[model samples]
Target: MVLILSAFLSSINQVFYAKWVQDIDPFVYSFLSFSITLLFFLSLTVLKSIKVKKSNIKLNNKITGMNSIVVLNIITAIIFICFYYANKYIEPAIVSAIEIGIGPIIALVLSLIIQKSNILKFDIYVCLGILIGTLILVWASLSGKSGIASDASFTYKGLLATFTAGIGMVLATIYSKKLSQAGWSTYEILAHRFYMLVPVTIVFVLNKKASYILDVFQSNWNWIILFTFLGLIIPLYLIQVGIKYCNPLFVSVTLTLGPVFTFVFQLLDPRVKWSWISLSGIGCLCVFVIIKMFIQNVGLNKEKPKGEKLKHA
Candidate 1:
């Protein structure tokens, strides 16, 4: 039940994140959102701070304590900028689909290259499914009543941007995993991730020649707070928590549903027609995921050793 709610909220989060990225500097926003959320979470720590069970502390205090976070900050700033721009030029649903759709494939390839994973038959099938689904989605998008030329017009640019963002995100995930394996607590990582963004955002916001930080104070704070809470704090925490419990690749696969959920919400919003091609592609991808999960679980069950049977003995 918790997982179900988490997944549902995670989907809605992609929508709110799309909206939030519009007005906020992605770097600063990422920073501020985490900073704010950290404070909120930290406040809970004050009331009920459970001591993190101490594990072997391999964290390189000199090299990783502050320095590593600093590097991640810079990398995340760049990622957010790319994401913001991509969302600006393309529909959020489509962009989300393309970015997350390719995550498992890219992650698998990178894992193999980095010696973090072994190539498997099912991985290939998953990759093929993702590719086919993506192509079908693109084709459907092009065939819309809006016309093929219109769909194809920004397709390449939009896809490239989203794809690049996905790569960045994958790299970030790998790095985070490495850091976590080295003994960084989730809070500590989140703190470092957000803390680094502070300065980056300041520079970006200044360079934009937009209103200064003080300008934000003059605007309505309600919606801003709402967006920050719903879009950033809540969802980010959920994702971080979710990844803690499940395979990262599976998390990426679950996120693919973001586009489907977004499309459903949008249809109710503006009365858009669903295209058969896209619907079928989504169905195929989902069916493939379910089948894969069932097979993997069955394999796991088969691998378990049976206890001695007293009656037979």
Candidate 2:
């Protein structure tokens, strides 16, 4: 249930993120959003520190997964930038479908590799299914008849950006799980993640120009605040909680809903048009995602009885 809610909120936020980044500079938006979220978490951290005794303060300072956390934060920043840029160049629905749709498969593969486990036959089959679905989706998006575009160059760049974002997301999920195993609380992870992001974003904003920061504040502050809350703060916290509690593969599979939400939202926008081919591709993608999840669940259930027997013996 928590995983579902986290996925739903995260999916919903993608729509708002796409809309906001259409007008706002991606770097500026990233900076403002992270800064706002960081401030909120910083306040909480400060309050907690004040409430705790001096002797206990050392407990909070003992960071266990510093390397993994740093890598995760870097990947997260890259994902934010890539997502914003991809949404600018590509239809949000297509971008979400291709990028997020492939994440679970990536996470599964990475998990196996990191654990030094032999790839199961089932894993290969599932990977083939995901690859087929992704190829179909990409073909549909690139086909001129599908209404996405005939411009190969533009579509290629968008696809590349979205794919890069997907890789970043997969890595982030795996590392977040690692952090959880390494003894970081979800709040601590979330706070530290943004703390790492804030400085990098500041550098990005400064490199663009000091004026960009001013522009972020001067331009629709209301929308910025709203997007920060709905698109960044809330969804991020939920995702961290979900990652902490759920298997990374399961969490990634649940987040496959992001493309579905993107499609629905895009359907409401008059500017975007969908073709039958693209819709079919999206259907295939969703079907494969569910099938993969079912496979994983069955595999886990089978493993459970064996573990129970071992314990009994």
Candidate 3:
């Protein structure tokens, strides 16, 4: 249920994110987005510290997952960079489909190899199914048939960024679970994960013209808050909660539904033209994800659940 709700909210988030990027520089948007999250969690941390001081309780400064935290922050910054560039050049629906769709398969393979477990033949078929669908969607966007010219350089950058982010997204999630295993609270993980991103983005934001940044803030401050909570803050926390209780593969499968929802919501925007090719690609992607879920369900019935392993991993 947490995963499903997270997927649903994330689907809506892609549309808003795409729209915002079209209006402002992706670098600025990315900085503002992370700033909102950082500030939210920072407030929480400060309040918690105050409470602990009032009670004279000793704060536990001995961090157990510094390595995982460092890795998670790096991957997260990469994901945000890719996310902004990809959404700017590629259709948001396609970006969401490929990023959310192909990621789990790769993560599943890596997990199996790391555990030295057999790769199910069914897994191969499912991976191929999702890949084919994702490819079709990419072709639709890049074929000069989706009302956007198929400029190689223009489209290639977005595709490259999206794939990079997809891989990073999976690795980030895995490391996040590792942190949870190390006993970091969800809010702490969320708050501290931006250690690298905030400082670096602050540099970029400052490099821009002050008047332009001020104008952007004045014009879109309301949207900044709205999308910050609706898109990043809430869904991120939910995803972390889901990650804490579910395996990465299961979480990825559930998130595949995000692109399906994005396809529908994306069409409601006038900026995006209706493309039969795009719809077909997303449809195929969703069908494959369903089949993969069914296969996983059957396997789970015969043994201890994957979530149990992830919780302990």
Candidate 4:
């Protein structure tokens, strides 16, 4: 349920961005959204930690456990920086295919290497199917038959950045899962998730004319609010919750459902007029694969309970 909800929110996230982000400075827009999420999550955690303290909740995470979170934030910041760089050069369809399609495969390999787990033939096939499905969607988008339409030339620098973003996603998931295993509460995990948006901040600062940010706020506050809460924070919190319960590979595959969900949301817009027949058909097969993987993951994790729960979490 957590992963599904995360996927849904992620899909809808594009709608919020479409409504708001297009007009403003992308860097400023991202920074403001990050600022809002950070403040809300951090404040909530502080208050909850105070309340949780009086009740004698002795959560096991050492102060140093936050090291993983710090590392995660850095990686995430870099990933988005890479994504922005690549998106400018690569076709959006290719970008989507690379990042979304490649993420789970990275996770599977990471699991094999870091966890030294035995690989099942079935897992390989599912990952391949997902890759193929994503390629089909990208192909559709390129043909302008369905999905996102785009026109841009691919460059090696852009390709490198795309792979970086894709690989960074799996690495972040791994760290989140490691933190969960260390008994970190989901609230605490998220509370520090965006400690610093180093990449966005640097670019925003360098762009000078930073004063335009004030104008953006004055003009687009409502849209920014919607973008901050619904698009930025909620889906991320859900992803954290998912990491707390499910293995990285399961979470990775689950996140890929965004494309299908996005296609559904696009139908409501007259401009997009639903046309993902091929995408949806293959998406359903991918969904079945996801369900199978989820069932298997659940059975594997049945013995362990979530680390700690804040009423807020």
Candidate 5:
């Protein structure tokens, strides 16, 4: 239930974010969003720590933990930039569909390599299905049969950006999972991430004149505030909480709804038109996700019997 809500919120947030980035530079946009979010989380963290006094919120001073958080923030920053640019160049629906669809596969491979985790044979088959679906999607987009309103030439660049963004998201998820397993609270982890991001964003914002930043805020105060809340704060909080309660792969899979939501939003917009080939591609991706979910459930059921027998023995 938490995962579902998180996925839904995240999906909606992406649509709004795609719209918000149209007038703002990606760097400037990210800086403002993260700055506000950082302050919000910082205040929350302080209040929570004060209430508990000597809470379990210990600092993870280990080199491995520190490295993970640092790398996670860097990847997050990169993803923000890539996704904003991709959204600018591509149709939001196509970008969301392809990017979100590809994330789980990347996460699975990264989990295997970094954690030496076992993979089910059925999962391998499902991955193949997803790959085929993704290929169909790419072909439909490249053929200019997609419903998205973008130039064919620029679509390729958008696709590349979305692909990189997906991989970066996967990496961030893996690192966040590691931090959760190592006894960090979601708030602590998120706070640290945004805190680290602040310095980098500050540098980016500083490169632009102060008046330009102020003028942007002045012109788009409502949008900026809404963007900060919806795109940065709420979705990120949900993700942190969802990841704390669920495996990263499961969380990523749940977010497969994001593209569907994006498609729905596109349909509501009078500017977009759906094509049969693109619809077929979307259908294929949905089928792939359904199969992946089934395989994961069956695998979990099989594991339950072994655990039961071990407990009885």
Candidate 6:
């Protein structure tokens, strides 16, 4: 239920982000959203007086000093920038769908090269299925009323931006897993990431027109309020809380449902047309996930650990 709720919030956030781009500067936009999230999360941690008593809360020895947090922040900032730009150029549903596949693939490839992890046969099957689904989605987008096939220039730019975001997301996920293992609180990770993002955003804004920010402050604050709450506070908090209790795989599969919600919202958006190919792709992935879960459950039951009896109702 947590994962499902988080996914739904994320889908809504996408729409809010689209509207947000118009009212504020992108760099300021990034800074404010992340800052809001950081403040909200940290406040919660303080109010609750959350401790490191739980194994999950303890920082890993590997993530000890500020150095690791610094590195993680750099990687995270890049990922956020890439994602925002991708959304600027492409459909939200397409970006979300492609990102689902990229994270696992990039992690797999990186582990093979650096960690010497062997890719199993089943891994290959999973990758192929994900790729097929994403390809169908893109094809569906192209076939629909969007003139993607006709306008060569816009098509190339949009596709490039979205695909780059996918690659960026993959890198970020790989780095984040390492950070998580290193003992940094999930809150700390996001905090450090926002710290990095804010300064970089300030520099970018200053380079363009530092004075524009004053205009931003003078402008109607309602959009910022809406954007901050919807895009930053709600989705981030929900996702973090959800992941805390859920199996990582289950969380990921639930997130794959994001595209489904994105499609539903897109139907109301006059800019894009609904595509059958993408819908079919999403359906196929859902089926694949259900089968995968069943297989995993069976394997776990068959190899139950000694001294631990399976409880029956």
lDDT against the true structure, each candidate = 0.58, 0.70, 0.78, 0.66, 0.72, 0.60
Model 4, position 224: C-alpha lDDT score: 80
lDDT of 2 by residue, 1-313 (tens): 5655655665666666666666677778777778888888777767776786544444444465688877988888788777777777677777777777787678667767776544445555655676676777788767754434536787788889999998888888888888878766676677777656677667776767677678767777887788778777777788888888776666766676666667776666555677676677667767766776676556533223333431100
Off by over 4 Å in 2: 52-61, 118-124, 145-147, 207-212, 292-313
Please give the lDDT score for candidate 4: 0.66
Instruction: Return the TM-score for each candidate structure.
Output: 0.74, 0.84, 0.88, 0.79, 0.85, 0.75
Summed backbone clashes in each candidate are: 0, 0, 0, 0, 0, 3
Candidate 6, position 222, lDDT: 69
Cα distance off (Å), candidate 5, residue 226 = 2.2
Please give, for residues 232-252, the per-residue lDDT of candidate 1 as tens digits: 666656665656655556666
Which residue pairs come into collision in candidate 3? none
- Candidate 4 lDDT for residue 172: 87
Off by over 4 Å in 6: 19-24, 42-65, 111-120, 140-151, 207-220, 238-254, 293-313
Q: Where is the poorest 10-residue window by lDDT in model 4?
A: 304-313
lDDT of model number 2: 0.70
lDDT of each residue in 271-291, candidate 4, tens digit only: 454555445544744674566
Local error of candidate 6 at 311, Å? Answer: 20
Question: What is the model-wide C-alpha lDDT for candidate 3?
Answer: 0.78
Q: Rank the candidates by lDDT, best first.
A: 3, 5, 2, 4, 6, 1
Give the per-residue lDDT digits (tens) of candidate 6, residues 102-141. 5455555665677665445555465567677777767755
Largest TM-score belongs to which candidate?
3
Q: Cα RMSD to native, each candidate?
A: 6.0, 3.9, 3.8, 6.2, 3.7, 5.1
Worst 10 residues of 3 by lDDT: 53-62
Report the alpha-carbon TM-score of model 5 versus the true structure.
0.85
